[model samples]
Target: MPNLLSRGLFNLFFGSKRKAFEKLPGPTPGVLGTLGDFIGPNPWDVCARYGREYGGVTLIWMGPSPGLVLNDPAVIEEILLTRRLEFEKGNIGTQIRPTVGDTVFIANQGEDWSAKIKVEPMAQPWAAAWLAALVGPLQAAINESVDALLKEPSIDLTPTLRRLTFDGFAVAAIGEKTPDSVFEDFMLLAKGADARLQAKLPLRFVSFPEGFEAAKERFYGYFTERVRRARAALNPSAVDLMSWTLREMPTVSDAWLGHILGTLFYGGVFSTSTTLVGAFHQLQKYPAAEERLAAEAATLAGAPLTFEWLRGAPWSEAVAYEVLRILPAVRIFLRTPAADTELAGVKLPAGSTLMVSNQHLHRDPSHWKDPETFEPSRWLNGGTARDPAGSGYFFPFGRGPRECVGAPFALLFLQTALATIAARVKVHVDSTEPFEEGFFFGVVLPKGVTGRLIARPSQAASLPGSVHPSAAVKTA
Candidate 1:
């Protein structure tokens, strides 16, 4: 309640000050891109328009607040790096507070975030640590799903990928096998809540299960109990997050452990799944790109790709990058001004919202040579400068102090899972209608896609050493 009031007050007081923040001089558009396109097909169109009108840094209003949307790579770098400390997770953080609680999303600022930052389990951990052992389990899970795919000539690989991701990360992160029934249903509710939360819309009329909150509480209860058990059983050589966090922050309690475990599990499952589905949709939309990926797959190393091998495939990486750039899992990333601050020279009153959309950023021709063209080679070749602004401008894993912790795992999942499947079978995507794109359940997906692809064995040249026929190395 106080949060709502404070947010509303922020807009009321500083609405006019944000004039310089936007490229267009007027009110902002909705999901659609134009003045009348609020309810239009593509809301991110505004992002492109704004990028053209505004320079690198611009501001726009959405959902009753003003957010500074950045298009320039250099400014994104400054915001993500030099001046990162000045920002916070904004209303999107507030909306997700119900599920994430004091977890990092809402705690995107202050000493709490800084403290958590100290223990962030990111980057490529040592090769032999449990963190590194994760690639094996994730790959295995992807292989299993691919093998399962062979049974059906055409299956909606979206949920199939979702299930595999759930299992992959569960085994790697927490050492559990999520029951498909429970996990699938959980995916629905969790994703639904996330979409609304991400939208920063009012949830006054929403309905939920009687024990929804309690069930999550119980899950946390179980998570901490398991953490405690894992702590007690830890060997000096064991290198999982549980053991690592315990060794570092001996004062950490069950709630923190639970939050870490639960958040990782949730973030791990849906984001990867949606990305894979999105890529598949777009690849099918453009058959030539799909065939090109398959051609690269046919001659992949004779052995399946190891994490090392798969990670280096420029074409494969482009596929994943294009997927992220085009079909970003969520619509907008929002952050609050921790206090009064200046953004890219605009005087944003303290407490205003800040938003940047990948959908908008990805399509801007100013940065990308041909924003509308679906050529994976452009991304692979780096024909255009890496990015006009810098790294964070085109980021899907976000940037700086608040970037995603599960990024390595997510990429590992993508490269490994897609490689495993591509190695084993060919995707002959046939759709009844255009793959209806949306941020369905928050993670994103085709609205109603009924398509089937033929997965036939390919007897093409294989990359030696990196991947061998039937031998697999994967990620999730």
Candidate 2:
């Protein structure tokens, strides 16, 4: 079967008439045809090597299949914006279908995707309002998580931030806190899904990891019950993702609703956690930046952590944007030509895979000054960093019509949580080891930062509407 598959891919991508694809510059493929580079621990590093050596658009062989790494912003704009319809999430949709199902917005395409977009709660303009309404719950979640962090003199920031983001996501998504056991199951399910997406070809054909199905079932069951309970209560005044989804798609099945909720949680949590971790790590590295953030957060004393308020905190917003630019959670994005198409002056046959490296594009020397440096100030009005929204060079959340629907929520959450944390504690990284990163499935996980959370003596007390850790509700 392996030989047959290899022969099929070879014929499909390397036909005699495929002069255009054959002429594209890239490293010579190994026996595994560069598949190892993608499935290995440091695909992002390999992608950087490709961009640095091969220029903007480079061709790579994944098994016998031809995959193009789009490193140039012009080509990126062409594929992701100008000719978006020509390139869809074909291969990626197939890869994540087993985990998120085809009905979920990310995996759906064409007319179905168009229809789903309309009902997607996160895609709606009112999403900000829904998120704003949860400021109290979200702030409480952050406070509780920080309190847990303060319990120990020194600790690993990764798991702590993970719990922090998960709790915040629970409150914003489902109107309550989630149990640790459920979080464990969801992590297993997420990791398993990522494994399937990043697995080698024949293994990629395999559906789920060893215990994936069980973990998914358990995770789904918990969410299914939550969906049913939300339906039963049917609070029109409620302002969580689940509530919005229910109100928008009133007739959708409980299972379908559960999948939507699960998909958002899966997409939102880990990425936010890693971004926060990066923010803290960067802040610790640049003491002046930390001091500025602390000063800005200080002004928020006696004010609610509302969306409007968080939006006004420019430094916090800049820090979040900078961290996203420097350490994108999903390092690479996969797409495929829907039909024979030309990108960057190179013709690609239908179904050919395209890999866009966010890491490469984010750090491209041509578009950024000292691209390697972690400078949050670049995002400020007069700073050197280009606006990601306007510049094709930066797209941590992606670009075009299919850009991450959850971006607003993610940004709001990041700003609120970062400011809230800055207001409550000072993060001191005792070791440089945590700054090291590893690629997992597609998400970048930091090598757990060992840090001490020093409590700000009067910071919490100064906040007028602060929720005490003990007073924060643990249940719905």
Candidate 3:
């Protein structure tokens, strides 16, 4: 019966169009097409292999649905930037809808999406000041996490970073720190969403772990309450994300606001935390880079860790960019054509999925020098690396009109966290083994990676109040 259904789907999507994708290269599809490949242990590896062996544009079959893996920078630019309106979130958006609801993160290109983007909190010009105001709260959160790390010398940095990011995001976006229970609930919901994505099937068919529904209710309820409170205290001068969002779009529904806040929290917390883990891991591996960052941090000793200060630290910003380039949190971006289109001489049907592999593009030899090497200097000015701003090759935050709205805030948070930690302690990854990358609720993270922190005595005196001076000096 399943085989018959698979065959039926195959014929329905590609009865006569199979010939169109015949020239493109990809792994042979199974009875369920390339759906099996994506649900496997390492779908990212499959994407990398497809790009390496199949050239710039590779055809993939998602069951009956035909998709393209786009590795070419030029092709990506055309799809993501030039003809962006021609594409919408499509099936991928549907996959995420169960988790984030109909928020801007996964909303299709339409009037609602347009309105959501216009009022997206982090993308606003005043977003810098809002994020700047969060430095104290963010730093306090980071300090608490670092303090805990100091007590436990050997620990998995992933969880520590996760807690830090969640707390920081809460303070910045929700206007207060969330309880640990709420964080756990959010993780539960996020994990369920990731499971749905991997299933590559409709949400109805995907089975989640026990407590999933309760977690979802709790997570959404928390955000819903936040929206209500923001509405009650609506102020034109309020600078927090929820307040700002409400001020911009007063007529928006409470559920819509809740979903928007939930999506931002989910998107910001997990991805940012994973990126921080990767940054710390990379810093440990490349001591020279660590030294440079520490020195840069030292220069700003006693200086307030303001938004401007964090953004102005060139080497820290460069290292953050390098880590993002090498280990992008979001490995794959999914887009679907709103109308039938032609890409690289191949015709694509309307609604066909377009997958862009950041992992492949970030390391593509043609676009990067020493692509495999962990070289932070590549992002430095007057260096050999192309400027990511002008260069289409680097897009960890994605590109086009629908790019991650929290990009500026995320970068500032990353730069500040990296600089703060580097100044106070020297990171040492306990595991000498090469990192084994895996997906943690759709975000890329290292598995079983443990690290220790040694106090840097030189900068202890200059450390902030939140960061314990005695603990920093005694942690080693």
- Best candidate (score: lDDT): 3
* TM-scores of all candidate predictions against the true structure: 0.77, 0.86, 0.85
* lDDT of every model, 2 decimals: 0.61, 0.76, 0.76
Q: 146-227, model 1: which lDDT tens digit per residue?
A: 6655556346667766777777766665665655554644554475466565453367655554556666666566568778
- Model 3 score (lDDT): 0.76
TM-score winner between candidates 1 and 2: 2
Q: What TM-score does structure 1 among the candidates reach?
A: 0.77
Model 2 stretches astray by more than 4 angstroms: 1-23, 29-41, 204-211, 382-386, 459-476
Best by TM-score: 2
State how far residue 109 of model 3 sits from its true place (Å): 1.2
lDDT of 2 by residue, 1-476 (tens): 13556545555655553355766887655545666666645877778788999987888776666779888777777777777767777655666666666654454456767888877777777776787787767887888787767767567877788888988898887888888888888777777667766666565466665777787887878888899999998999888888887887789888877877777777778788888888888888888999899999877664667767775788998898888988888777778888887776677778887888778878888878899888888888955244654257778888877788888788888888888888887887766444778755457888868876766656546544443433332220
Q: In candidate 3, residue 163 scores what lDDT?
A: 84
lDDT of 3 by residue, 300-369 (tens): 5545577677757889888888888888888887788888888777888898878877788788898789
